[model samples]
Target: MSAFWRDSLAGLCALLIGIGIARFGYTPLIPVLIQHHWLDAGDAAYLGATNLAGYVGGSLLAAWLSRLVPVARLTRIAMIITTISLAACMLPWGFLWFAPWRFLTGFTGGLLMVAAVPLMLSRAPPHLHGRSNGIVFTGVGIGVIASGTLVPALASEGPAAIWGGMALVAGLLTLLTWPRWTPQPGDASPGTRGTTRAFTRPVAILLVAYMLDSAAFVPHTVFWADFIARGLHRGIEAGGFYWIFFGVGAMCGPVLAGFVAERFGFYRSVTGGYGIKAAFVALPILSQHPVALAASAVVVGAMTPGISALASGRVAELVGFAAHRQVWGWLTGGFAVASAVAGYLMSYLFDSYGSYYMLFGIGTVGLCIAMLLSVFVRNPPAPAAQAA
Candidate 1:
């Protein structure tokens, strides 16, 4: 394979294992935990909150660690830790054990999220950066599909087996990408030390939009499967079934976003993505029709990572290659912090209200704000200058 494809594949696998399995695999398991009487709804929410908090830590750590260690080495270490954390969930430990393990998993996922894109983009040519980001984010959808479909099927074998199965998948992915984790001599090009400079208007707007997107995503990312299972009176399997649509949407979303970015510009593509996401966020609340919800799942799933891919590409476009890692890290860190806050807040709302309406309603508002914020983002330099 060419170096670009090799790097992209490795990055994709890294995200599939780290963010997909280690971080998001927990979403499908929440209903199972309740079904088995292993955790109540409140406890499940707390676990999600704790994991998001860890994600915040991991994002910041990746930024700081980038200065001290090679990003390639940090990514490899993060992937290994993420695998171990996923497997650790299989232990017969109580909620106390699960909480810490979940936190660790999120932390490792954060590291990979911040590090992996730079690793992949480092190998691509300038013009391919937009498409490269879309390709890398596709791994998250693949991982979501695995957890949403495979985990529920494995639920009959009990939590231990389900956890172990997910871990085994992560382990296998780890092995596949292990050799490529080592940094090639030119991977971290000279002058790529990310700047600590003040943000320009475009970067600032992008940051706010990213933060809003993070918050807007909480309801679906953490609770959609549960809503289908409990709120809609569908069985756990049915919830997982809907999540399959979500995965399918996500799988195709980034590619579409990349195509739009190539034509209309990344900033415009992301703005359009958030606008579409807002409508989908309100769909399940509007009707219980299976088709409507399925359509909602597909659109929301597409916009989730679709926005991320385009936004990250926009950041690189505004800041230049040298600052890509730093700017991306800051953007991701802000997003993670917002997600952690939203996770806990949504948990409280859920526990208090016992309904998904409020949760998704809030998400709709957040996405609208994100869409408006995204509209403010412009190319920091002239198109020709940015291209050069």
Candidate 2:
């Protein structure tokens, strides 16, 4: 394959290896575990929650440690731990064994995201920020799909077999693509003194907005299959299959964002994105048709990338290279904590109420907050004047 393919493939692998545990591995595997009597509902919920905590902790470290550790090294370190921790999956199946590794996996995944996202964007010519980051962010959806699809396919096997197979696949991919990766210029770690605070008002708002988005988004993700299967009375396989549409919807989000931002101002582009996504959050409850699900997903997915790209590009614009890495770390770390909390809350609601309605409610509220947040973030004043 050409360098472009390698670079793309490598970036894709970073996401796959990163969230393979929290997003993909655990959900499908939980069913398998229950069958084996390896885990109870509480065990899985607690473990997934711990994974979120670890992710936040990792992102927090990335935010500050980048001052001393270079963004590339941080990503590389994350990749290494991600690979190693995944290998640990094949080791055993105790609740204690899996939970800590899962948490570590989340931690490393956050670190990788902090670096990989901007590095990929920087590889593009300056203005292609929308396209590069969009593609990278889309990988989150693809990774989500892969996790669900791959886990169920392996579900017939023993839990060990499933985890072992995924670990081998993820670990090999990481090893093969190591050399192809490079950090963006100025993304390198500086000495401790360089870790100055950069919490502009916009940054604070971005952080809060991202956290709310995460809290709202996690429920749909963590329990989508269960909702479809149990709530809608679809079979488990059918429900899981529906999530395929969700992934497709999400994957399209960034591609459309690229086109949208080109046509509209970045701020408007994001506002539109959040607006569509908010509608889609309540869509399943409203339309309730399999076809509507697909349509809703595509439209919702298409809008998200614009907002995310707009957010990142705005950060790069506001803070300049002097502190982009640090700022992103803070914003994304807040997102990680909110996501973890949201996931846990959703699980609690499911086990409590036996419905996905609450998940939809959470999504609705979150997207609305995200929309309001977008309005507050106007164009960063022209760089020349803002730099002072």
Please estimate how well model 1 matches the true structure, expressed as its whole-model Cα lDDT: 0.83
The TM-score, computed over Cα atoms with residue i paired to residue i, of candidate 1 is 0.94
TM-score of structure candidate 2: 0.86
lDDT by residue for model 1 (1-388), tens: 8877878888888888877777777888889888887788899988998999999998888766766788888887888787788888787667798898889888888888887667777778877776677778899889889888887799898888888898889888888888878877777622334354526777888898889989998998899999999988888898888888888888888899878888998777888888889999998888989999999999998888888888877877787755766777788899999999999999999999998989999999998998898777765756424643
Rate residue 307 of model 2 by lDDT: 56
Candidates' C-alpha lDDT: 0.83, 0.67
Worst 10 residues of 2 by lDDT: 186-195
Deviating ranges (above 4 Å) for candidate 1 = 189-198, 379-388
Residue 62 error, candidate 1, Å: 0.6
Clashing pairs in 1: none
TM-scores, all models, native as reference? 0.94, 0.86
Q: Which residue ranges in model 2 land beyond 4 Å of their true spot?
A: 1-5, 20-22, 64-74, 90-92, 123-130, 181-187, 190-198, 296-306, 320-322, 382-388
